[model samples]
Target: MVPYIRAQNVNLTFRPKNRDPVTALQGLSLEVGRGEFLSLVGPSGCGKSTFLNVLLGLLRPDQGEIHLDGKKISGPGYERAMVFQEFGLLPWRTVLANVELGMELKGVPASIRRERASELINLVGLTGFEHHYPHELSGGMKQRVGLARALATDPEVLLMDEPFAALDAQTRDLMQAELLQIWDRTKKTVIFVTHSIEEAAYLSDRVVVVTSRPGRAKKLIDIKLPRPRDYEMRLTPEFNDIKATIWNSLKDELISRGIGDGR
Candidate 1:
C-alpha cells in the first residue's frame, strides 16, 4: 500500500546570527502508512521535532520532497494538524472558542463550526469544560483541548511533538492512555515525536529510531501487538522486550553525543 505520508532524501539546515550553520536533519527519510501510528525518537537536538515540522509543512526542508496521500506537499494544509508540547492554545479563548478557531480559519460557517467543535470537544472528553479558559484547565486538560482543536479540522494526519513531555509522570501516563484511546476512535494517521522508549513502544505501530544530530534513520522497529492497548499490556514481557531492544540500539548514539544514559 502506498504510504499516506512520505519524505524522501530530506535535508534541513539553519544559520543563526553570528553562529555557524546548524544541520538539523541530514538526508532523513520516512514514510507513514495510512491509519498508521508512527513514532520518531532520538536524543536531544537530534532533529526529531524538525522532522515533524517538515511533515506538517510548517518548515521547508532545504532539500528533499514530501508527499501527502501521493500529492506533493508545498505548504501547510488542512489534511495535517499539529499538537505541540506547549499546547499552543490561545489563553484568552475558552475551550469551545479555541477548538472552533480552526474551522473559522477554514471559512466553515459559524453554526457548523460550533457543531463540529462541540462534537470534537465531547470526543476528547472535554464536553462539560468547553466554556473554561486555558488558564483554568490542568496541563492534561489543556493538551486535550489542543488535541480537540487539531481533530476539529478532520485532519488525515496528526503530528504530535512531545506533547506529554511537560506533564507530571502520573499525568503523562494518563495522557498517553487517553491518546491511544483517541487514536483508536479517530483512526487518523499519526506521527509522534518522543524521547521515551517506553512511550513509543506502547503507542506506535512502528517506531523510527534516529541517529544523533544531523539525524538519519537508524532503525525501524515494528510493533505487532494488538490494539486497544492499555496498562495491562504494558506489563507483559513483549512490551519490556521491545523497550530493551530500543534502549540497546539507541544507547550508543546517545552516549556518543555526551548525553550517555540520558543523564
Candidate 2:
C-alpha cells in the first residue's frame, strides 16, 4: 500500500534580501505508514519544524511535494492537526473551552462540541481542571491541554513540533508515556519532531535522522521495543543502544555544522 504520508525530493530555502539564502531542507524524501509513529531528529538547522509546517501546508516546498493518504497536501485541512511547543493556549479560555476551540471553528454545534471537549479533557487527564484557565495550570498540564485540543478534531495525522520541549524532565517522561497510551487508543498517524534521542526512541516506531543545513534523510532506524511502554523500558540496554545510535548520527551532524568541537 502507498505510504500514508510521503515527501519526495523536497527542498526549502529561506532568503533574506540582505544576506545569502540558507537552505533548510534539500532533496529530503520520507514515508510514514498509516497509524505509524515517526520521529525526526537532527541538529538545530535540519528543518524538522519546516517539514512539519510543509505537511501542515503552512509552507510550500520549492521542489517536490508532500502527500497524505496518497494525495498531495496543498493546504491545511482539519484532517491534519498540529501541537506547537509553546502550548498555544488562550490564557482567558478554560481548559474545556480551549479543547473545544477546533470543533467550535469547524461549526460544530454547542451540544456536540461540549461533549467531545469533555471527553478529550478527561482523556488527557484534565477532567477536574476543565474549568481552570491556562494561567492556573502547570506547564505539563498546559501541554496536556494542547494535546487534547489537537485530538479534539479527531485528525488523521498528528504533527507535533517538540511538544514536550518546554516541560521538566520528569514531566516530559510522563507525557511521553501518556502520549503512547493515547496513540494506542486512537491509532492515528503521528509525525513527531524532537531534539532528544531518548524521547524519540521511547516514543516512535521508527526514527528519522537528518543531516545539517539543507537537511536530507540521513538514516531511518526501526525501534523494536514492545508496546504499552513506560519509564522502566527507558533503562533497558536496548533502549540505550537505540539512543546511542541516534546520538552518534546526531553528533556527526552537529560536528559537520561546525557547532561542536571535535574535542
Candidate 3:
C-alpha cells in the first residue's frame, strides 16, 4: 500500500530582499506508513517545524511535492489535527468548550459536539475539570486540554510539534504513556517532533533524524520495543540502548553544527 504521507525531493527557500536566500530544507523526503507513530528529531532550527507547516499547507515549498494517503496535498483539512507546544486553548473557554472548538468550527451539531467533547475530556483525564477554564488549571492540566481538543476531531493524522516540551519531567513521562494509549486506541497516523531521544524512542515506531539547518534525512531508526509500554519500560536496558543510539547520532550532528562542545 502507498504510504499515508509522503514528501518527495522537497526544498524550501526563504528570501528576504537584499539578503541571501535561506534554505530551510534541502532535498528532504520521507514517507509515513498508515497508523505508524513517526518521530522527527533534529537540532534546533533544522526545519522540523517548517516541514510540519508544509504538511499543514501553511507554507509553500520551492520544489517537490507532499501527499497524504497517495494524493497531493494542497491545504490543511480537518482530517489533520495539530497540538502545539504552548497549549493553544482559549483562556475564556471552559475545558469542555475548548475541546468542542474544532467541532464547532466544522458545524457539528450542538448536542453531538457536546457529547464528543465530554468523552474526550474524560479520555484525557480531565473529566471533573470540564467546567474549569485554562487559567484555573495547572500546566499539565492545560496540556491535557490541548490534547483533548486535538483528538476531538478524530483526525486521521495527528501532527504534534513538541507538545510536551513545556511540561515538567514527571508530567512529560506521564503524558507520553497517555499518548501511546490514545494512539493504540485510535490507531491514528502520528508525526511527533521532539528533541528528546528517550521520548522519541519510547513513543514512536520509527524515528527520523535530520541534519542541522538546511535539514535533510540523516537516518531513520526503527524502534522495536513492544506496546502496552509504561514507566517500567524506561527502566529496561533495551530502552536505554535505543536512547543511546539516538543520542550518538544526534551528537555527531550537533558537533558538526559547533554546538556539541559538551558544555
Candidate 4:
C-alpha cells in the first residue's frame, strides 16, 4: 500500500544571530501509513519537533519534499491539526468557546460550530466543564481541551508534540489511556513526538527513532503489542522488551554524542 504521508531526503538548516549555522535535519525520510499510530522518539534537539513542524507547514525545510495521500504538501492544509505541550488555550474563553474557535475562524456558522464543539467536548470527556475557562481547569484538563480543539476540525491526521509531558505522572498515564481510546474511536493517522520510550511503546503501532543533531532515521521498531492498550500492559515483559530495544537505539546515539552513562 502506498504510504499516506511521505518525507523524502528532507533537510533543514538555520543560522542564529551572531552564531554559526546549525542543521536541524539532514537526509531524513519517513513514511506513515494511513490510519497508523506512529511515534517519533529521540533525545533533545533530535529534530523530532522539527519534523512535526515541517509536516504542519509552519516551517519550510531547505530541501526535500513531503506528501500526503499522494499529493505534494506545499503548505498547511485542513487535513492536519496539532496539539502542543503548552496547552495553547485562550484564557478568556470557556472550554466550548475555545474548541469552537478553529471552525469559527473557518467561517463555520455559530449553530454548527457549537454543535460540533459540544460533541467533541463530550468525546474528550469534558461534558459539564464546557463552561469552564482554561485557568479553572487542571493541567490535564487544559490539555484535553487542546486535544478536543485539534480533533474538532475532523482532520485526517493528528500531530501531537509531547502534549502529556507537562502533566503529573498519574495524569499523564490517564491522558495516555484517554488518547488511545480516542484514537481507537477516531482512527485518525497520528504522528506523535515524545521523549519517553515507554510512552512511544505504549501508544504507537510503530516507533521511529531519530539520530542526534541533524537528525536522520536511525531505526524503526514495530510495536507488536495488541491494541486497546492500557496501563497494566507496561508491567509485562513484552512491553519492557520493546522499551529496551528503543532504549538501545537512543543509547547508541547519545553515546556517540559524548553523553556517556554515569553522571
What's each prediction's TM-score? 0.97, 0.96, 0.95, 0.97
What is the lDDT of every predicted structure here? 0.91, 0.92, 0.91, 0.92
Between the candidate structures 3 and 4, which one is better when assessed by lDDT?
A: 4
Candidate 2 off by > 4 Å: 261-263
Local accuracy of candidate 2 as per-residue lDDT tens digits, 158-193: 999999999999999889989999999999999999
Error of 2 at 16 (Å): 3.1
Q: Which candidate achieves the best TM-score against the true structure?
A: 1
Ranking by TM-score: 1, 4, 2, 3
The weakest ten consecutive residues by lDDT in model 1 span: 254-263
lDDT for 27 (candidate 1): 91
* Candidate that beats the other on TM-score, 1 or 4, i.e. the better one: 1
Give model 4's TM-score versus the native structure. Answer: 0.97
Per-residue lDDT tens digits of candidate 3, residues 144-251? Answer: 999899899889999998999999999998899899999999999999999888899999999999999899888999999988888899899999999888888888
